[model samples]
Target: MGSTPRRSPRRRWASLLGATALAVTAGGALACPAGAAGTNVDFATHCIPPAVAGIPPIDGTTTANVSVDNTSPKVGDTVTVTYTVVTAAAGNPTDLALPADIMTPTGKVTLGGAQTGAVTVAGPKKNTPVPGKGAFPSFSMTGTFTVTSPGAITLSPGDYNIHTSYILELDTPCTVITPPAPVSETVTATSGTPTNTRSISLSSASGNPGDSVTVSGSDFTPGATVTLAGRSGDTQTADTATATVNAQGTFSGALTVNEPTTTGIVAYEGSAWNADLGAGPATYVVNDTTPVPDGSQKLTATVKAGTLSMSQAGDAVALSAVDFGQGGAATGALRTVTVKDFRGGPAGWSLTGKVTDFTGPGAKIGAGKLSWTPVCVTEAGSPSTCAAGSAGIVGVSGATLASTPDGTLTGGEFTVDAGLSLDVPAFTPPGSYSGVLTLTLT
Candidate 1:
């Protein structure tokens, strides 16, 4: 009796039909939609939540958490709001939007009630998902919302809602939200005092004649004029500041100490403005003189007349005159002279010469003059010519001369004559005579 295989055939068929119906209801009900149960499309509502459009969050921020004062701000009172946004999904939302409202919790939002501007977002976007668990995209945003109001408006401190939303087109379910990553930044302007530190130096402390000294300094104004104190005698101003100093703060100027003395030069930062930088002192020296002659004096003498007589019967007879010319003198004093006969030409005949001195006391002779003497001579022969004799015979000597001023006579004259014969000899060689002339101060 195994329970009589016990089922009726109809009973077995009914049981099979009920089980098939239950399976069909369970599978077909969930499969009826575009996506199967527990699939990505099944949670589409979660992935694409209702968009909360409002003011945008700050860049690089994961969420929008801004602090705004709901006080009734005056017309000029600037009320700023800081907003932050962060991505919670593996990729950035294609179209993210933000919106804000300032009103009581129960008041309806009005477009004209608030002042707004388009939000600016900056950063890289992720178009594709990561390989494994997909990357949790992150970003930050910072924005300042200025309040435009004429009077005070009250608002209690609370979690003020800032609508933030984004879109996700990927088949896999993904969430789009601006996490609360709020940040605040305050900017202010203030003024105090400027800093000024100046210094000056001279490259060289001293210099020679025509030498230049350089002066250098720092913190100098552009187009500044420089002046050296006592060194003005040698310092020269530069034509331009750029020529003197480069952008690196180096300056150079030359000071010529032409004078033979220690001079000081003071450099001023600017001519128009008085700013004494420093001073440089320098010295210079001078030296120079004239030329003089080597040889002290020169002397020259000339014989003007002379001739030999043969008719007188014995030897030669001649008469001649001498002249002393110009001389150079330093003391401006007169010089004396004396003469003698070396060869007696005849009886009662003598050789003589005269001296004329032009250099006087305290007198300067730029060009000197000449002096001459009268002439007398005698004959020296067998029948010598006598002064007063029938056989008038004579003997004579040539002239001898000397000057008082040693080595000072430049030129002079001498004379010779025959006492009893006129034997004028022709063709005599030109005679040049020299003597040592002494020079004295008297």
Candidate 2:
């Protein structure tokens, strides 16, 4: 945001909230009375998204209201929290309205005190995506968190971001600008003892086959023999590991995972009977370690499609007429020819041109008398320039106008043009002569 940023309605006033607003106490920000089941906190947040595409840069403020279902939840209890936009981004009437379907908003809430982690909140899939200004959608997001430890659990409005498909590589940043004190609530809990839940964890989540994976468990009946069996898919392997639980209600030992059929998770678990006493299962990933030796096997495939061809810019071209006043030779340029090589590369291609004998009112001219100087040009995506054929009489044998090297060309388009010449016999009669020039591509 610039130093003199024009901010949103609710957000700009964050600095206005001072010690004169309320007596700073030990966090009693709830809309609920002094003692209530659930709690609510009111605050202001500001966001400034950089200019993206055609959307202008906008930094605005919005009021937020957050509430929780259980303020004094015991340890191990899951609590649901809801964060609502009390006031939409309708401030700053000058802001350009964004069209719909481009944005799907999602956000986060910061947690502190007893629990130290952020809660994920998902917003509506879409808002009013129509074109407008200063009227952002007012939405709410709900998330859950399991209470791990019991104490004064504090919740604060945190930063969030606007997600848009228009510029996926960039992110819109927001901030919690509640100036006075972060609007927060204090959670008073009853039990401090954490629940001893049956759970299993592995030291390494993934490894090659035969790698030793340490299986750890907690809260199992102390001193009981923990039988940790290894299973790949539905089949249990012969190798198994066991460890005696200490009086502290925990155990950890090594188990080797060696499944050869496929690359996937290999589960090492305690016996089902031990599951009744707080023993769970864990898994170790096996790498796809299958070796491919040289000269073992070869697979080949072929796609038979496409072609090599040429196209003329026009149907026909009329060369400049020459007067048979004691003639020797006459020359003109051929029409622009484009040759496309879509023949799946390799053996290269050839573009040849030839002409038929010209017939006039009194006599006929020999086809072998026509000659051409061909020039081949490289076009877009062409690997190399097509080689120009020699300048000589072409009607005697087809002229190799333009051709690529044996292993050089790999499917691209090239342009070609040729200078055509006619040798007029000195004693020939004066008349208008016409001939057909045919171009071929292979």
Candidate 3:
């Protein structure tokens, strides 16, 4: 604060007279009139009152409070401390400079290589208030103490003192006011350490797409967020699942191997994180496979002269009477053809199927008119593109079978589900027509 310019003695007389009269009426302060040139007045004797007869002088009380960011501190962990001092006083503004120290259970603490302190004021507030000499002032001082020692550092809650070098200035004479008693607060320090080890485990060692697997763990920091992720060979994906460590330091939740995940061993990793404890990670595994939920990839080979073979899922496919009736209506049963690769090298194979014209009786149905719709099936129990087909379904020109890798041998064998349908014109002569559906694989 900048000081006001000094006024000449003659110019100060009127204001001084009025201030003296007011001070005398108030009775707390002594009254003194401005002196004449070269005639000095004993200002302290007249303006500084020994003591007020009735009203008690207003004074301030100091309080120290502390809080720690992390109650459990561990190696490599830095914690923060918030210390605040509030003084309640309603009187003339008294400027006080109070020193504060953060001490461990054993000794005092220094943050940023310096001692901390709180300066107090009078009234009911600390910051900007209605400014005037008689306005009761109240204020508070706060400091952040950072503990970077990593290990255990006890936080003393109220082990501090509010020392006052408080000074009071008046209209004529300035008198220093000192509290008769020393004010200090005794406090207890709280300390903790982080030294818990974490471990994780999976419910099972393997699973298929959409299979539910339990992820369980223990010894993690309480209330920490844990995320689970999975990786298969070169492909990585995040599980849309997470768990929070409970008060007992344990976590458990069910996560699913997302559908369409690659057929391989998927390695799962989970980690728990907290602001104070950092991160702890663990790993597990899930073997994701095909048609069979086989954790072990055991491929038993059955060799034959052919590179591919086709067979119906159940008995021979039986077409209903409408399929053979006269309206050009087509109908048949669904049959799955299992194609096995005995001739495994990397060279691809193709399947071409055709039906011979009905020849069992006097009249026949043209074989070329028959059509088949085939959907390729993958080991993952889902429909996939055939290795060598455009429409994938066979027409009059005959459709080519599709295999993975275009031509090379991928999984030893694959299955294809095909629907057989025959068309009969309404005018066509009909006998018990019988035709052989020939599916040749190369």
Q: Report the C-alpha lDDT of model 2 over 162-182, residue by residue, as the tens digit.
A: 554332323455566764326
Across residues 89-199, which tens digit of lDDT does each residue of candidate 3 receive? Answer: 223332322121100110111222111222111111123232323432232222222222343333322222222111211111112123111212211223335343344
Q: Which candidate is the best by lDDT?
A: 2
Q: Per-prediction TM-score, please?
A: 0.17, 0.33, 0.27
* Candidate that would win on TM-score: 2
Q: How many clashes in candidate 3? A: 14
Instruction: List the candidate numbers ranked by lDDT, top first.
Output: 2, 3, 1
What lDDT does each candidate get? 0.24, 0.53, 0.36
Off by over 4 Å in 1: 1-197, 223-243, 272-442
Give one digit per residue, the lDDT tens place, for model 1 in 303-362. Answer: 221111111121211223222232221111111111222211111121122212212233
Model 2, position 111, has a per-residue lDDT of 70
Q: Where does candidate 3 stray beyond 4 Å?
A: 1-310, 323-326, 342-344, 381-385, 388-398, 406-409
